[model samples]
Target: MTLAHFLHGLRCASCGTLNALWLDLIRALVECHQCGQTALTLTDTDEGRSL
Candidate 1:
């Protein structure tokens, strides 16, 4: 859902990379391919954060 919503994907704040692929087979957090930083999740106004 996250990946589908943000079709172009989010840019990594640390390394500045665009990650648009499947986050993981079991997880939902997308990792930075360039910096290898696993720092991303889907958060709503009331739900806080999701992984």
Candidate 2:
């Protein structure tokens, strides 16, 4: 089977740490390098809004 993936962005809910995200493994939990916190939430803020 063929696989597809997309890369987005991720932010820490507590410290506001932003990073790249891959849609292929989004279901898998990721951790933040700065605050040592796991990825709890993801949002699209390119349109000018607070996530």
Tens digits of lDDT, candidate 1, 1-51:
233333266777777667643364246566656776774666577676666
What C-alpha lDDT values do all the predictions have?
Answer: 0.57, 0.52
lDDT of 2 at 44: 54
Q: In model 2, how large is the Cα lDDT of residue 18?
A: 70
lDDT (Cα, 0-100) at 7 in candidate 1: 26
TM-score for candidate 1:
0.43
Off by over 4 Å in 2: 1-8, 20-27, 39-51
